[model samples]
Target: MDLPRDAQHDAVIVGGGHNGLVAAAYLARAGRSVLLLERLPATGGAAVSTRAFTGVDARLSRYSYLVSLLPRKIVDDLGLRFAVRRRGISSYTPHRDTGLLVDARDTARTREQFARLTGSERDFEAWQRFYAMTAHVARRVFPTLTEPLPTRAELERKVADPAAWEALFERPLGETVEAAFADDTVRGVVLTDALIGTFTHAHDPSLRQNRCFLYHVIGGGTGDWDVPIGGMGAFTDALADAARSAGARIVTGAEVTSIATDGRVAEVAYEDAATGRTHTVAARDVLVNASPHALAGLLGAPRPPRPEGAQLKVNMLLRRLPRLRDRAVDPADAFAGTFHVAEGYRQLQTAYEQAAAGRVPDAPPSEIYCHSLTDPSILSPELAATGAHTLTLFGLHAPARLFAADPEGTKRELLAATLAQLDAVLDEPLADCLATDADGRPCLEAKSPLDLEREVGLPGGHIFHRDLSWPYAQAPDAADAADEAGGPGTDVTQATGRWGVGTGCGNVFLCGAGAVRGGGVSGVPGHNAARAVLEKAR
Candidate 1:
């Protein structure tokens, strides 16, 4: 919907992702005239829910799934109408007839399962202690995500546990995992969080994995990644509704072309994607909810090094949950939470090494989780009664370059390889249980990073926009500090402050995942960006 641009808005937000929607809501709630423009026909960029399988009523969270980053404050402040439930089964990793399973409600069963797999009670004890430390760190650090960032020294003091800080921040995550568990499967399970959308050796001296590891562990005050009730789209829907109710003007199918700031106000030029009619509107300030690269293009700034995404997303509607070869547990138990397939520690390293060298691995280390198992709201009554379920798979180490050479062929080969790996653990072939779509085609679709870039505006298909930045305020090293101290081009991150969302341009700011402490579906970036704008307006 296009609104009359006769009057100027206090702020204009580009893009309609959850972050963009969030920034608009908060800015408007503060009594500012906010106008948000989105390129897509509808809001909710990647956090979308769609009826993936035609002829089926199943609405799968197409891109992003689960909930952990969104804080309770945003939910309560917006009065958003949505619910998230905890998965009963934490995770299941099958190895032949027996597998390692973590039950959220049953510790005794979990311990027994662990003991059976490792043949030792020590590993389970270590597992409990290790997570307990992470839980404490999560409670301490998660609150700061939406607030002003503290310096590294202050955050470490606040954490107060030198060992915990060093283990997570200073050392390689693989070292911590290896030290904590004897079994490779358990170690791999722990390390998976560090490499969600990132591709790097766990021991990379750059600590790229460290930042990724921290974000995953410090979400939702419990570090427990939970399932969204309806789908990821529910969160975006609620966010959009909140923004609209707050008096924010949200214009969809409005693709912004350029932004001109005269160190005072910004003029936003956009084209109506449907009609091809271009419009330019002025705003007192502009909040860019697009990627840093996307914003750079709009401002005609020098582009940074391209970031690459590393994951293969496969959405499937199953006729029935495939039977687990392990007879001790039912399919429901295996498919509930993160169901690890061939994701052992050594196995993960092997895949990473191969993918890093531009070759797809023979066996990919990925995981599957069934949304219907936890919340059946995503599926229709008929589908539910017919034992239909929605399965989302995340394959690691399938970087953008791997598909660059052979997009379709590589995608097909990787998908086949990953499913074949999955078949190795299950009693029956995964393809056999796939439901048919409206056209009678199998209900399964795979996406590579190349595909993600074309569909969604993720440059290089990076999920977090770029590599996740450290949450603290201090400079990592002397070289980075020198860069911030005017050794070269402008350092936008310097103005990003402990909580500031400035993009180095006084009138322009980053309101997307590229912003400090900006990642996930949390809405922290949006909330913090609004806070920055409100503070400046005052």
Candidate 2:
């Protein structure tokens, strides 16, 4: 289990998450000696799919559900045999006895639904105009993510439209949402993107919500979140295959204990769980596919502030899709896309206030989506024939702080309350539709922020590894500007250059969600890190 005494490689990758796998594949394919170390028994990280219930044939996307920010370039570049199917219904939000369903196939019906929900077609018009502007921005900015860092001024100029730039990048997202949409439900739907896994309100001057919103909307240059054909696990599995086929050595259950470098060559020490023996591998470059906080600890440096995640994740196997209280909308259509519950604009604000005050929201704002409805490949033939389905719920404004006092007690209370909120919008209780496990227990599982931190190695369970950041650089001088200007060399003490993956150490780089433009299932940081090293070699 221990690496050879003189083991060495051109690149040593820490953490075998999707990003690490990506870096390995690219580096190895380029003919660089590559070794990737993963602490877990598997390499998917939080993006893996699992059958939570015993004796169940369903494999649910446990933590990260949907894919949006992952670029098509990564898919093609690696020759990954994976595909994503777009949801037919964008979203459905119920209020009282009625709902607003946005059917992608039927814009006329969607327009009609919007009018019924808001009592006017003006909001729909505004929605179209607002998204058109975002689409413009998406087309302009998304391509730059893989390129060298561009300064704020450069990105603004590239954006061209000053009005769009100012509305999205300069001002608070809540202000933009309120100015564009008059209907509370409509406003809430738009604002949910800004709040997903981010613990900030819409109007915060910090603009954290804006960053989240930008990433959500600019994905694939169209902002549509799609379902992976098999499951999230299949996507990462493809990455792993690509890495191995390209000659990257992947070691699972090998916990990286420390990393040391001198701006030239680096030494990585890992403990092989199988042998409980530590081994060291020397490499010309080190890619850290872990959170910044973890990277700091590994490098014996001061760690950043612990990130606080604000959400509750629940996965369930349903005997049958829950019927909606609004009978006019079919259960398949309602659950196929994002099903909003108690997420009206006012309700969202109130929930934020309650959570900020160290209490669970009276009615948690959450969204549910049925992966089975889109792709039944995760289900066995028997389960599929029985009309079984998988439902994943994301409860917002339930911060890590809320579970500090009593993790299990809080999770139990929060899950019940959140489901009750869903029940109010359903014809019957959600429990009525749950498929029992082989152990005769309800097929339900809930993960709080605390649980994510413990299991997934996410600091405070912050899903993005920390707060989401602007894809482009904010500084007046791009980090790599000097390099472009034929500067002497990369700053060894703070090595970040063009790709935003650079660690302070010259030979070390970040290739994970903590890197700029690096959240979600995107392999951008990994690709960028490899590019940086290859460029340096050139």
TM-scores for the candidates:
0.96, 0.97
Kindly list the per-residue Cα lDDT of model 2 for residues 1-538, writing each as its tens digit. Answer: 6777577799999998888988999999999999999999999888898888898989988898789878899899999999999999999999999989989889899999998888999999998899999999999998998899888888999999999999999999999999999999999999999999998898999999999999999989888999999999999999999999999999999999998877677899999898899999999999998888888888877677889999999999999998888988999999999999999999999999999999989999999999999999999999999999999999999999999989999999999999999999898989999999999999999999999998888999899889988877755255555433322333322335678877657678889898888888888888999998898788
Candidate 2 weakest lDDT stretch, 10 residues: 486-495
| Model 1 residue 328 CA deviation in Å | 1.1
Best by TM-score: 2
Q: How high is the CA lDDT of each candidate model?
A: 0.86, 0.89
Model 2: lDDT equals: 0.89
Model 1 pairs whose backbones collide: 70-522, 149-498
Residue 90's lDDT in candidate 1:
89
